[model samples]
Target: MTNLQDRYGRRFEYLRLSITDVCNFKCQYCLPDGYLGDKHQHFLSVDELRRVMHAFAALGTSKIRLTGGEPSVRKEFEQLIEIAANTPGISTVATTTNGYRLAANAHKWRQLGLSQINVSLDSLDPELFRRITGNGRHQKVLDGIEAALDAEYRKVKINVVLMKDLNHQQLPAFLEYVRQRPVDIRFIELMQTGLGKDYFDAHHISGESIKQQLVALGWQVQPRGPQDGPALMLRHPDYAGGIGLIMPYSKDFCASCNRLRVSALGKLHLCLFTECGVELRDLLGNDQHQEMLQQRLLAQLQQKDATHQLHQGLTGVTQHLASIGG
Candidate 1:
């Protein structure tokens, strides 16, 4: 049997892996302008990623999400998806993308059993989009969304991050877009991370506020299956797809947090709000280090906090959000 239960009793069923640390867009919330990493190194070869996936698969992980600075930019990302898809017991293979390069590769990704695509689209206005993601390819992103929708990607969720004074006004318009488009529109509250510290301030928007707005618009908010990370999903009276709220600030969800994050350079993060991480890439290189590191991985999984302490009181952040592949 897969070693699915951890030290804390949290199931090790879901794994999120960052395929690369690079990105094409300079999203303002991700990295600041003139950001430089002259000597930064990336993590995990396609083979290494496969090994990690296989190891985790032995632990009962069947759902895996491939993330990145922008995963599509990773060389031959489709190959990585294929490898993960073919992994034993990995039933769900998904990605969180900015949707810029998705159009050109949607068909290939779908053919490889990619089940979900979460696109981050902050604003409908191109100027605002450019302001939000420094690279400014809103049209391309939208086109990618269309292509994915056409390709029948199992579930396409649009991530609309609402920050006050930025794109709050577009909430109604975005909801309208989702209503007619058949995509599950998930509104995410701005998170406090490296970008929250180095690039921008925390944009306050709560799930209660969002629910109130939806109520005013003649919609009802009904909570669906409790999510593992931050998103709490709800549905309208007659809407086919549901609306999800990702509350990293308002609610500290550690008890039901069944996810683990693998950074681009192979650091294992048990919590999004933690300062500590296990450097797996470095450990994997030394053949002499494998046994000890393997034991440590299991120990840390047992120590994984059910929720994060971020909600404790806006503690200052140090890790760059870009580093986490948010």
Candidate 2:
């Protein structure tokens, strides 16, 4: 069981697989105009995705996260979940969704061996939520959150993309929400990805500012150990659950990156900010060259960029978050 280790000494044990690039909402920061058209519609079949998971599991991968514009919107999403959860070496299966369909499927997800769930909930206010997602499904999302809680999932988390002058004021409310519920809320620093550069420039808020505010409020921050992803986990003595901050800019978040993203079209993204990738759809299901394909993937993993260059003010990001499965 040789694990996939990168040049920077980060072992890639978690795989973020984008089952589809299509999404229901037009989140201002993710997909401004909804799903990318036909050109981006190419997606991997469920069987192909299963085989890919098997390949990664054989390489010592133990966790697989299903991501997408909205993984719940993908057809036969449960089957995909089951596949990864049942994979030989994979021990955990998780999904990051917009919570549109979570309410209806939360129970099924829990029974399917899904150890964790992360739902994106930026704003609690209905109108503001609609404005942020560009869709009037705020009530549904809230209902989904409630349903997730009702499902009694082992790990339920809410993801908040903190944007300046947008949903930043909701941080306190989020903290309160987590205290009342068993779920944890994570605040992700707004990233400068493709297709949303203008929006990011206008709305990007540093997680550091939010953290300072929390500290000023007398919140005692207790450090938690390694997380499933890149978030910096903190426990507050006053708060019931944990709070996670993913600071990609102020900190060198890429230095400890331990995951790889596979696009819906079967392209491997060693880094979320980079467009460089290795296509693997053609090699799926080919036992004759499976070893060769694994070697090729290992080579690419070894070549992963030491760190994301966005921190240095570099531009030219052409991959949108929706397309990259963030």
The best candidate by lDDT is: 2
Clashes of each: 4, 0
lDDT string, candidate 2, 204-278, tens digits: 888888888877877656653454457777766666777888998866677667788888889888888774668
Global lDDT of each model?
0.75, 0.82
Tens digit per residue, CA lDDT, model 1, 264-289 = 77888876666677778766664465
Task: Report the C-alpha displacement of residue 298, candidate 2, in angstroms.
Answer: 1.1
What is the C-alpha RMSD, rounded to one decimal, of candidate 2?
1.8
Could you report the Cα RMSD, in angstroms, for every candidate shown?
A: 2.7, 1.8
Error of 1 at 250 (Å): 2.5
Question: Once superposed on the true structure, which residue ranges of model 2 sit more than 4 Å away at CA?
Answer: 39-41, 224-228, 315-317
